[model samples]
Target: MAYQLRGGGGVAPDLNPLPPEGGEQAPPPAAEVDRISSLPEKARLRILSFLPLKAAVKLGMVSNRWSHLVNTPQWPCDSILAIHIRPATQGPCGCLVPTHIRSDQIMPLLANELGRRGRGPGHRLLRFFLKVDDAQTRPADFYSLLDYAADCDVEDFYVDAGLGPPEVSFNFQRASHRLLRLVLFGVGVNQAHRRPMSQERSINTLEVITIENTSLGDLELKWVLLLCPRLRTLVLRNCRVLTCVDVTAASERLVRLTVAECPQVDKISVSAALGLHSFRYIGDLLRSVALPPTCFGDLRICFTKATLVDPIQYHNWLDALPNLSNLVNLTICSNALKIMSALRNRENFQTQVAKLSNLQNLRELRLVLYRMNTLMLSHTYGFLRMCRCSRLRNLFLELPKARTDSFVDAVNGLAEEPAMDGFESLVKVKINNFQWQCIEIELVHFLFRKARSLQKLILVAPKGTNPERDQSGNAIFPDLNLLCLEKAPANVEVQGAQLVLWL
Candidate 1:
């Protein structure tokens, strides 16, 4: 007869029978044994920590023992608790209409959750993600939540107010040392606050910090960096108020840095970062840049404008590239190509190309194109000719949406250049947003003729465009037949052409 397991509230059967009237009870039946209940409490808690907070809460319904364990102060360790405050109603158009949610309405719920955890030395939280979609969220609520997370020894803390205005100014004077990653989006920084002597501390455990869509000044940015002594990655995007980013103080441990869309940043100085391996700057070319002399493994410089109106400033930035020699991978935008092409006839154009040739170690190159025109296409070819093609192994080209039917005529009318050596080392070429237009086919043909070592060609279709079905429910491009059968070269492997559809 099966017996009920003790403390299981009649939910699970005790597989071990009273063996032969207390004559050495047989080992518990392996198939029906409760293996999870046999593990230590710490091990079980660790397994539960991998689950989401909602799933952990639902696990309490299994049995009374589980319910008690889940309700304990140390139930969850290294778990994530995400709270999103986005109250909405259905609109007439069947869309979600965001409704106003006050901070007072959310504070009580947060308090109740935090109270249940009973924060102390025993509790630990891995990540605390809080996103407020309401514009009325007060700064005090953020502070209280941060305090609660610190009390629980949270490791990763992410706060996003991007759905609303940038009104929350965080004061990091009392930041905890247990934080390993901090991400703040659409949040400002309080510049006037100073840490008191009794609470003065540094977040030495932080390894990554990302700030986006925030209004931060240079002094405040430096102040935040100074508090994190072990930061390895720092990303600043769309921070309009930052004029300069000087990471000399935090350069010792910095390995990667990215600054994107910060239009006002005039200068970026990273004095002596021996460990920096990757650096990406995406915006207008900076007026001043001071980087380490070490060879970078990856580098990206993407200009937002098609052409900078000022010729001198444009040439000055191009002249600065030779100093960053020996990059393994490089990504540039069509704008840089356009600017460089305009100087094709000038004497310094060759000089610029020669300087760029200093990057003999470069292997991969990515070109982000905004439009497909004859001028830009010619510039792209010229830019490739400048690089050491024998060493380049990968080529990535991002194409914009096709708008005009004149592109085919433009490609046909383009002048032919003298035959040159092909890309002997190119192993892969990827084209994103591929439209099976005449110009795209012509580009593929050009690559087929030039890249002698080409092994794989990746053609990614435009978003939501299916290669399997057409608008009328007809089979379209069965097995990507267009490229493999008609366009691909005979010598090159046509089966290597891959079609990717982005849903």
Candidate 2:
């Protein structure tokens, strides 16, 4: 957290007062205008600090002395560098008119001031927040200004711009060593820059990077992998257009990678990402890439739409995970389950589970029933019950968004798993949006009869239901003393279950 900002919209309240030169409160005796104009140079700098990054730098025009101080060399390691266009000056309402400056004049002026200070230290956070409201906001203008920051070694660069000429790129001479979180909007990576991108550079200190709402036309993603060797987390959301992507040798040192909402990335090329710890992807795994992945930590995939999936066809992915034994927690969502559904028989299902069954260390199993329709939820739950995960101690069931249902049938299916004779290690169960039909009640009762070590049962119930109704003698689970009903109304009558557990 480079620096905390006040007010949510990236600007402080009391816009007219003019910020002091630093971060502190000024005394009242100084009076308004007197305090602002008469304050010591450093004090004025403190006041200016309160102004948003844009307004603060603009203060150079207020006075020659102000510009001198604004140009002072210091490591601005935590300033959000906003580049959104607005009228030359703010309006009367104190709210800036959303209108952007048309000419490319502001960049040269602003860049001259900051660059005159000349490549000081890397600002721990430099956000280039641009709003693409018109065709006039050239990508070159934005890129040149960002080029200045990349030269200065900005750590966090967020670019929300428009699609300009296809021939565009930022060739950082030394490669940004501190660049961490990089977000883009309405831009594309040209093929011309692909090779230089693959050329190894020193992005040794980078972390989380995201590319959003844009098209990565011919951008070789491998550059991000090879060049940014220390990167641990990445996200590319809504980048709807991409043709070729090769990320084979790119996985040197990454812990988390998230690729959601990117409709066009045709294929994912990876041989074995040795250090990859977690992965979240929505697109199909292109046959070009070997599977039975080597990612030893966690894998999460979100396939919101229905698609044909065959996990066994890519058995190489499963086999590639030499350390599948090290793979502990597995969350299979829409796309993943779709692939698993392609299996023809229990033998195939057992083969799939067998790869991970050696993970005796596995403890938590989360099943997201594409709870779209009642039938879908039933089938999902039925498919899950077929697997024998003796080590599972916790289970989570998620419902599809908007396809609302209190899935009592699915809950019953879980309790019906024939293996429920007595799970010695099993202790807890959590159901999100839990609806209690007789199936749910019987499931609860069944847990009491089966899980000898069972201790907690959590349910999310409908709003306004009095939990006191659940304390009846008819309720089972004499051992079920801890009932955590999250986000319902205030709970009462936990006494009977407690008394029974003690008895």
**If scored against the real structure, what TM-score would every candidate get?**
0.73, 0.59
| Candidate 2 structure quality by residue, lDDT tens digits, 1-503 | 01223443242335445445796556445334333455576656555544544455667777676787666533132444544543333333232322244345657645565554555453333443455444454566756666666766665566555533343444433335566566666554434344455454556666666766665544445555555666677677786766544555456656666677767665555445566777666665544434334635665555565654445664544444444556556666654554544552447455554564355555676666554443454344444544445676876666443344444444434423445522566788765544444444555555566677777666655444344334233444433444433333334532112211211
Among these predictions, the greatest TM-score belongs to: 1
lDDT of 1 by residue, 257-374 (tens): 9999998998988757778888999998778987776778888888886556854566755655535466788888888777776765578566765666566667898998888766
Worst 10 residues of 1 by lDDT: 90-99
| Model 2 TM-score (2 dp) | 0.59
- C-alpha lDDT (0 to 100) for residue 142 of candidate 1: 64
> Which pairs clash (backbone N, Cα, C closer than 3 Å) in model 1?
none
> Any runs in candidate 2 off by more than 4 Å, and if so which?
1-119, 122-141, 161-175, 190-204, 217-219, 243-245, 292-295, 307-323, 334-353, 372-394, 404-415, 421-430, 433-503
Reference-based lDDT, residue 310, model 2: 45
Q: How close is candidate 1 to the true structure, as a TM-score?
A: 0.73
